[model samples]
Target chain A: MNRSAFPPLNLRWLMPLLLALPLLVQAADPLPSWNDGPSKKAIESFVSAVTSEGSKDFVQPAERIAVFDNDGTLWSEQPMYFQVLFAFAEVKRLAPQHPEWKEQQPFKAVLEGDQKTLAASGMDGIIKIVGATHTGLSNEAFIDNAEAWLAKAVHPKSQKPFTEMVYQPMLELLAYLRANGFKTYIVSGGDVTFMRAFAEEVYGIPPEQVIGTTFVTQFQNQDGKLSILRTPKLAHNDDGPGKPESIDSIIGRRPIFAFGNSDGDLQMLQWTAAGSGKRFTGLVHHTDAKREWAYDRESKVGKLDKALDQAKAEGWTVVDMAAEWRQVFPFATATSGQ
Target chain B: MNRSAFPPLNLRWLMPLLLALPLLVQAADPLPSWNDGPSKKAIESFVSAVTSEGSKDFVQPAERIAVFDNDGTLWSEQPMYFQVLFAFAEVKRLAPQHPEWKEQQPFKAVLEGDQKTLAASGMDGIIKIVGATHTGLSNEAFIDNAEAWLAKAVHPKSQKPFTEMVYQPMLELLAYLRANGFKTYIVSGGDVTFMRAFAEEVYGIPPEQVIGTTFVTQFQNQDGKLSILRTPKLAHNDDGPGKPESIDSIIGRRPIFAFGNSDGDLQMLQWTAAGSGKRFTGLVHHTDAKREWAYDRESKVGKLDKALDQAKAEGWTVVDMAAEWRQVFPFATATSGQ
Candidate 1:
């Protein structure tokens, strides 16, 4: 039965060979990239707690919901949120058609390669850029443009394509969680539609499970045909305290586990930890400067001041990427998917 | 390996076992309650198409979304929509507060037990009843009222509690699809938050995944405290074409599977069918007058005219309640959670 591996005769790694054979191939050290440390142990313990049956830690099948913050947590969020970069690229691509964009503030920054002005735009400028590039399009057009832009866009930091910047350990964790019956959701502050464009191929999270920022969309009668219009109105933010509210509004049930990267995700961890029983919260602190950029407390991209203090106070697990992960990026590097 | 049961050339199902000890539980038969026939084969083929690895029929993990219309499809929408009954009861409950409602259109019909007046009131009366019974109260207060009323009230026909009336086989199907990596959403024409109150406890479908008709919601600054308000502005109507629009806008992916009982569900079924590959669409025809009640085409509640036609023309599976399902309601009925 291969039950001898676990000690105390109570911890069984494999369920009884039930009716249908298991679907996944048990690989070499599943998530081999995750480093050796308490962070790993914390993840294993939480996963086991909710998965193992007939134990007090055993979560019911229905309550086995896990939420992940997408940016800086599951994938990379450096220099800027990837969506902003996509918007800039989108503006650049449309520059020929929109000649007046060169005279515009945010659009001018995008066109002139004036990275400073774009960065200086900060939150408001980013919103302006996103709204400008995102509007007046159909769902198909948006997906097509996003796919085209992402195929060629590289991260300013790693100098690798944007998709290559995803954390390898987190990728395995996603697969592992799905294997153990947890419905994982990317509850991020990023636009749900934008993330949905690639999440399926990247994280294996379906569009329906992604709860994030959104905009108003309308149905239009276009040339005697019905079409969907993506508008610029703010729908849901899915950040800070909004994270908890979004989880309540979108997921309905309190999850048994939550994961995040920075202070923006502090409230989400708080919400998950506050759940009734067998709760787990883990934070990914960017600390691998060699393989990937590392920063904490004072980083502009994924600031961690509030969440750092809260995690330490509450005894939440803080994953140090440099020491805790053997590999930072997936083996599918810049050219792998190609 | 005991692989003789499956064709040797078709090793997709067995390969996982050799590669990894897949959890091999008999793929949960979602339609176990239904006797084997075209209905069962149709369900199996749909699951096979979407779940089998690498098949063009292979729906991506992100696209593995299924939606169900709640009233007639997930449960029972008969005699009248459940919400309609709730409005009638609400008139009686608030009778002590608003005795004037006794002279109102729908309220008067409900109070006087006059079906003629209720029909005459029609759109105007229905809107008045919905607005009156649904708004201006705290979400918690409304849910509490629903719970109390649900506990005490009985259906006009069969004298059974409304909670006892949900279809049991559909519940199994919901659990089954979820087991096979499908995200199940209750896309109903009912109130989103209202149905959300009991949906989790009743259907195991969480509120976030419940797409339904919605009203305008506002965050109000109430004397230095922030409280949310739900207004009757008719935000999203999740019926007919509204179902597909809501699915695309909220979920961002067309569903691979859809189910419903009436013409109200025809558009949703069409939406699912229009998705690329390995799709499943079903119509739940209430054909059992013995176990439940058979009414379609001309039935006042949950008429199945268009859907029945579409089911035939488009080769969609139709669930004849009388012949297919072994049971119609959850084993435990009334008194406690459905």
Candidate 2:
């Protein structure tokens, strides 16, 4: 137990090689893309509090659970949900069957490449498009379709593949949590199975830890084979208060810490607050319009008004994107349509 | 990292003092009550595999995720589901306000303490009883009511509290897993929050790692005050393939190891087998009819048909409860139960 939990054999020399592989993944100076300020201090403090067993705020490894909202919080959930863009490409490929879609409002707008009309359709229009595109498939089938799209699809702004649009600093945050013994979960408004498609490759959070909205599914025995049929019934919505509910349903305990962006995340933060004992509730504010699009009270996507007002009062740390993140997406990536 | 994660630095010699404290727990050795044979082998193989880093089956501290089923898997789920027992008690307590319950079949049976009528009514009848018992309550209300029932409720056979009905071998299994860098999770069909109420005391597993069925909830804000509400909604069912689905939806990885007893757990065992490289799935077969119940295939409670068949086919380890477990429940303070 003292050394490597293994005997001091030459296999020990092999152990350092295994550990070195991950260290090589990090730059010589870790967190090179982090903005220098209290924002950095805040992140450092939270990590230290949960990691330092000797400190007053020390938490046991078993109790260290940290949850994050995907989409805007992880990558750019701007212009449109990246998954929506994936759905659009899928719709075009499947367009041969749906001749009627050529005349439909959102579908016609999307097919005609009119981003304005598609935007005008709003959340209602988006839901209809996603449901139509994602339903009528097995869980495996849906995952394959999403993964295929990610393999080819590029972001509108970052020009990189949607997976590359992931925030570099947030990636650092995820690794930091893992290094500190925290189990991380991706609780998002995105489709559960859809996120599961590439969440492992992108976030290092496995399919099992991705909690999101689900289409209704039915277990069926077909020709002595077991299969579950997928339908467009709203199963679980991992949004707002549903975040905490889903956490309870899946993880079964109130998270010691939570992070999110927008009013859609307000309920989750509040539910986290009701939990007794030392807790942390942090919100990611998308306020870098220069580097990244910024909108709060007036934005349709990832609206952060109610959460902003409560952040200061609740003493929840609000990370200012422009001031906190030295970089958004990885430098290896380039802007969209570049 | 070699030293204890928790140290008595400021209070010197505190570790020695703490170690000297009499452990309140009983049956650290799981041989006295466990029946014997394969059940013992299953336990042994699991501990040996995880602890042996050179065995090629060795699991790293970070990758060690172990899942266990509740009810029949951890404790006896006979007569009826244990959670149902709790629900039945709560239903009766609230019966004075619901006059219609007297006219209902299961409720009428439950209220009158007529075990015969309740048993005769069957699954449909049981569902009716559960719905009547579990709904119309807040999350806090449900948890408080459950804890109250647990405090007073006793097993008819043991005459001790139901909490004491936990398998002593399983407690040792949990501690052993943690000792080998594994995080143990109780994925049960029982109410999610309900299990968490006493899991820390009963199982070494903390509340956070427990996953199960859930109710819908709402976050309500009154002026500046906020609270969450619980509603009757099917969240996730941690049974059958649902066990694997829940594991995927919550844990974020395919556990390298799993344990369960009934046919209800066959899919979970299969899921564990599909894990990459090093994997183990242990099935606890209840063969000790003298001490417990021995019915497997035909027994409505804890039916083990699919799992027994699969264990043979897949070369999975099948543990015989009567022969393998040296002890079952913990003894009262002394080496024997009162």
lDDT: worst 10-residue window of model 1 chain A: A10-19
- Which ranges in model 2 have alpha carbons more than 4 Å from their true place? A1-32, A45-58, A96-105, A219-229, A312-315, A332-338, B1-65, B95-105, B177-183, B270-282, B306-316, B332-338
Q: Can you give the lDDT of residue A209 in candidate 2? A: 73
Question: Which of the CAPRI classes, incorrect, acceptable, medium or high, describes model 1?
Answer: incorrect
Cα lDDT tens digits for candidate 2, A87-188: 889879888899999998889988899988988898888888888888887666777898889888887776778888888888988887787788898888
Candidate 2 chain B least-lDDT 10 residues? B3-12
The estimated TM-scores of all candidates read 0.75, 0.81
lDDT by residue (tens digit), candidate 1, A1-338 = 55445234321222333213444443346667776689888888887777777778888776788999999998888777899888888888888998988798888988899989977888898888889888778766887788888788888876787877888889999988887888898989988778888888889987778888777666554553555678887756678867766666556667788999999998788768876788889999887676677798889888999899989998999988777887778753321100
Mark the regions of model 1 whose C-alpha exceeds 4 Å error after superposition: A1-38, A52-55, A119-122, A219-228, A287-300, A320-327, A330-338, B1-65, B87-148, B167-184, B193-209, B214-235, B250-252, B261-263, B278-338
> Could you give the C-alpha RMSD of every candidate to the true structure, in order shown?
9.0, 7.2
